[model samples]
Target: MRRQHLAEEIEEIFRCSGGTYGSPKVFIELVRRGRRVSVNTVAKVMAELRPAGRKVRRRRSLTRPGRRPAPRISSAGTSPPRNRNSSGQAT
Candidate 1:
């Protein structure tokens, strides 16, 4: 009986936030409205109701093929290795 009322309240808050209010926000709203409810209870009710918020999608990187040629790195051991300590300081 009480759960049903709480569910309704949760739904209303979720709707009011344009479905962006997840469990935490809903729980805070409930508390603000003078309702004695735990965050866990709100989370459980939300899970049961399944009112999911729309996730903000990340923007895809717009990369264009380089017009200039890439700098060539010589992998061949052309340069002599430097004697460095474990701390990377030149011995």
Candidate 2:
């Protein structure tokens, strides 16, 4: 049996959270409020109405060392000692 206008009320819940609502949580909340909604339906709504402020991280390409050492900003200041010191200790 259709509740006739449950989607509208549920939609408000999703909107109130700024579109960050997921189906399972929404389902639980609806159940708490004595409203019945299929989890699958909620998931479908989220897939259709994805919220804002969501981001995915992109994978980075691997780097290979060339004949020369890589130029890193970590050594920007404090020049190496004039002596060819392998150990940090001064001779």
On TM-score, the candidate that comes out on top is 1
Instruction: List TM-scores for all candidates, in order.
Output: 0.61, 0.44
RMSD after CA superposition, every candidate: 12.6, 11.2
Cα lDDT tens digits for candidate 2, 11-49: 777777676666777777788889767888766665666
Candidate 1 wrongly placed segments (more than 4 Å): 58-91
- Report how far residue 29 has shifted in candidate 1, in Å: 0.6
lDDT of each: 0.89, 0.66
- Candidate 1 versus the native: TM-score? 0.61
At residue 14, give the lDDT of candidate 1: 92
